[model samples]
Target: MELDDDSANGLLRSFGRQVQALRIRRGMSKAELGAELSYSQSQIGSIEIGRRVMQSDAIDRADAVLDAGGVLIAMKEQVERAGFPKFFRDARRYEAKAVELHVYATQAVPGLLQTADYMQGVIRMERPQPPAHVMEQHITSRLERQKLFDRDPAVSMSFVVEENLLRRTFGNLDMMREQWERLLELGRRHHIELQVMPTACAEHAGMDGPFTLMETDQGQRIAYVEVQRVSRLHTDRKHVRELELKYGIIRAQALSPSASL
Candidate 1:
């Protein structure tokens, strides 16, 4: 689904702000809204900030409870576009509303948790020929995408990383150590789960590469597969279903979530 680039981002930001405004206009505190909808205060905050995806059920309840305008309901189609690509403008839209995210990365640490220094080193190595400013822009964009994890209450995130990522030198040894430590901190968080797939793990589906699967509130799911320079979104029923099964298996085969670090 092609979208006007600016329109997509604008709509997303507006949707997030509107949700928060609607709740406030209705005199609904975050806790009250959560109580009414069975969502935690943090979950509600994430949804309001557009750092998370809003579920259809949540929308319906919001409209009824807060007497929201048909604004959000009308935006559903665009919201679906959030699952359209990797590194896509819509990916953030999809992720903002996701209640859960399961990811598998074989080549590198997940982008959301990567440090600026680590990202800069990785970008320099991968695009050594690019001009300095070009590399800086790329690095800046990467850092901006990380705001997804900064929302209050945080999103429920699970990562399955290949052991190779730990040994890969993104920059200098010191930077690699810092990156690993960052990963360890994220791993210990209450809402984050990190799993490592041992190098010796028998051949598996993820051997092909990294992918992320996100589940929205209304139970719809989207799969994002990334390659070196391109990422594809799998929205077809059969493709999505197949990935779901594969992801379940990978999660089971990977090291226990606690030991991934």
Candidate 2:
């Protein structure tokens, strides 16, 4: 489960303190711990300060290296979950298990497609902006989602993005070019389809707003919709079916993958 930001920050710092204490009790310096973990002293410093998120393997190594006796290991899942906003945690879980995902993105480029620079740019522009630690975690967690492409049974994915959204200069010219290059590279993948909804289109089916239709590994279909950071995963068959059909229409109306690229 995802905790509120304050709670998450508290937990992360608490965990960091525990790791720090264990290191000190072992009569070891951060450099020594990093050597054992094959991480740099700076990386160890970041983790110790709760400013960096670590992977499962790194946690295991840290657990063994710091002699924490599974204390740090036990906090693995919970610590990672804190990186995401509470409203989006459930959807993030299902998305990881998805066998098929179709995204209609109306705002910025969908998370799965965003370049790191583009992702950071959008996060920084958010209202009531997140603190530095939270912002780093946000980018890390979202980037972690891209690992879906590396899964054993890859998730077949498609996206229909607003053309105007692509035209927006999220950063300077170089960054924009990099983002477009990233998009073009992704569009070349066989299992993935990328389409653009041109502003010139007179007939549009996605006007109701952006939504994601996902089919899980078990063949269960679901729909995810979010607005203002409030996210919903609709598992009801009726609603999921409606979204599936709506997505078909949106794809039909959008420019083809080749044209989009």
Candidate 3:
């Protein structure tokens, strides 16, 4: 099915088109596919039209029912990744392979460190409201990304968040407290270091805004910067080096990891 509005990201629309075509080729109607998957026909229709976020497991279910020989299942990662903003996709891919991750967060806790309730609060504050399903999918995908912390041959990770993030109440006082406790727990891991930039700092290097620097196992470095809705991943050697220097300074200016908690 050719989508009239191409506004949705290409990966999402492509996944939807592939699902619709495979179902049709197998002599299955939307209703039949829904019945097989235990979803309502309208839910199936919404998925086919790219109006609904496809849950991770739904891809496997579709693959089995349509007997697509793993074709649909192979697209699961890309489909789930489509839940995030377009600019963030490449960074997510790089993060998965990074040997070391350095982050400087100015406004809020980094996504990987955020608790579910905290994430929901952030999502609810978006200017234009996202549909409930979309919001849930975003939350699910974000949580899935946190699995990187537990992967074998764990990645070395460091974060320097502004002190205000801990004080900022996202959902409620309880939620903020929980988020702080989670950060404390994460900091206890040998592979992770958590620091806070004090509000009383006379000067800081991260005034340029938040950015992440990632070093791959092969020693290649990349830098990512996001502001407002625009984000970019920097691969240029000189640019990445500059970001690395700035991050080093920011880390030095932040509170010691042992003192942060």
Candidate 4:
């Protein structure tokens, strides 16, 4: 499962090169390193070949075992930051800095609001299924993004989801029930406003698609729109203003926060 072009300067490949070089300098076989880190030899080999994402604790343990002087630990941030796809990187950065978020979801639950089981089910349904390890990396990365909800100065957020999404079963009955319960829990948060847009609603403004509008700490506003595999972050004032207006309308048409639950 090793990547063919490890010489390319991507973060994962670069990290793999560092790990391989350090392991060699220490005269440790992959099996020995895996034993020290309590991982399988194949796991260590995959990480060393840029085919697997290294968990933070694993990187820390590797740093110690290889006597890397914090080099691997320092690279952990970059590795985590690069966990998301290239198209999502800009939006991820903006979202991390946002003080407020307005989101509209049509087809499925938004990533921020999805439970682990729900996320796995959604990812598993992709047209061309990904390898188990790659899927695990994506799930881990998404769950990490949800840490934003626990920030000291919590971000104020509002969401409008299509009613069909609530009825759709992802995972299984038990998982779907858990997801519904989680939605109710999130709706009760002081900084969060959750609304459901019933199919019966005649005046829906989100027919165009799913989008997010974010207000940064400095009060700068940006809009993110995604379809298929492509995404765009709109920074132009006019474009953002239009999305803001559309979101306002969508929220107005959605069921009240309490009623939606």
Candidate 5:
């Protein structure tokens, strides 16, 4: 409930209110609008009260149905950003625009490479777990970030993931199998490289923990790290260089993409 008062929540609430107003002006009941939009009445209520975020296609449908004339369409970006945790919105922005990205993962799989079930399993691990709606928002935002994979001029990406992390059953064996399949599927992509770091290695450059290095098309370089739920984005050249060097060593230590796959 307290989360509904945050800046992100405020944006969602504002969007919801506008949708509600438009619906009312068109002489539509929640039930009727729900039918038209292919959502349940309760789902519409959840959206109208800002308890849920609607998908892009649904929003587009609602805009046309309500005669919003692009008003609702325009808020798409802001509403989408509201779906992520406050600490991560900035990091996702930089990651999305990266011309070249390298990741050294020690904990879970990087978000870009995760399956929906894996994301759900990871979300369940949070303390004082987020409400159901929050889970939807987080997952939605995560799936959105993966659009980076299809970007034209396709962003070059690589990840050095710890070997043992892949073996853990975050939820169940079935879910882990799906995730493994996903990894194998993505590894076949020409622009993405997946490496697995052996846990038996005596020395590891990334002992400091997981971090990512990103280089945007503009030539801007940055480093990102997160522990617990807190994250920092480093823009200072020296700090970025240290992480960059660590990633290079990590890639070397890990099995090559072909062997790892």
Candidate 6:
């Protein structure tokens, strides 16, 4: 049977969720789990959420820890060349109808809030160094993606950003200031929410890195988790429930919305 984009995306999400469920069942902190597998914490988190491909060794370790009985073992090979980042393509499908979006970012400003120039600068900094024209194409694509926020009945969007991201100059001081201003402007929008997880938040989920929760029109929900150069989408019902619970705890621990600025 052929799968449409949505169907394919859903399948990937379900896989991601399953990985997360196993992680929790094993009661392993991301750091501890990554250490056991000789991967970074981000790598462990990414694998669990299906944002990054599972390394063979890591999968073996996970199986051992969770006593998976090879349930997750078979999936390792299938996701080795999963084509796209976990949530990258799937996010576009639901952005239009998303009733609510909760995002946490520790590295940089959220993509939707990024300007064309900022994106170009980022693209230029990639290790392989995309050609100027290619970089421009990426900039265009990213900026165009931001237009969804302009839709009527506007999607409810909230962002929790690490305080350190605010001080790092992404493009230039002017650009950085513009980014902050853009954030403030978006927060002023009736449908949007902006918060900051302060450096003094006593270590929370944001410390584990960044993730996103998106609610679709039919009320189905999913989590999108990202790591360096990769992303994952998780929609397994059981996994979604756990991440949602953790997200709630993190939200409560982070700085208040008004105080975040």
Output the TM-score of candidate 5: 0.89
> Residues 1-261, candidate 4, lDDT per residue (tens digit)?
111222222677789889999999999999999999888889888778676777767889999999999999988866765666556767877898899998999999999999999999998998788778667767877887787788889999999999999899987899999999999999999999999999999888888999999999998899999998688999999999999999999999999998998
lDDT of candidate 3 at residue 118, scale 0 to 100: 96
Candidate 3, superposed: residue stretches over 4 Å from native: 1-67
Give TM per candidate.
0.64, 0.89, 0.80, 0.82, 0.89, 0.64
Report model 2's TM-score to 2 decimal places.
0.89
Candidate 5: where is the Cα deviation over 4 Å? 1-5, 27-41, 56-65
> Which one is best on lDDT?
5
Off by over 4 Å in 4: 1-9, 17-46, 55-70
lDDT of each: 0.73, 0.86, 0.84, 0.86, 0.87, 0.68
Please write out the lDDT profile of model 1 over residues 1-261, one tens digit for every residue. Answer: 566635545555677788789888888899998888778898678666554555555667776787876877777656544312225655656776778788888888887779989877766677435555445435545665565566565778889888988899965899998899999988898888898888998867676778889887677788888676676777777988888888888988989977776
Q: Global CA lDDT of candidate 1, please?
A: 0.73
Per-residue lDDT tens digits of candidate 6, residues 79-168?
Answer: 332422233655555554587888878887888888766766666677878555334434544665576688776778878788887787
Which 10 residues in a row give candidate 5 its minimum summed lDDT?
1-10
- List ranges where model 1 is wrong by over 4 Å: 1-87
Please report, as a residue range, the 10-residue window in candidate 6 with the lowest summed lDDT.
78-87
Candidate 3 C-alpha lDDT tens digits along 1-261: 222123335667677888899999999999999888878898788778765666666778899999899988887877766776666767877887899999999888999999999999998988797778667667867887888798789999999999987788887899988998999999999999999999999989988899999998888899999998688999999999999999889989999999997
RMSD of each: 9.6, 2.3, 4.2, 4.2, 2.9, 17.5
Clashing pairs in 6: 51-231, 51-232
Winner on TM-score (2 vs 3): 2
Candidate 5, residue 169: lDDT: 80
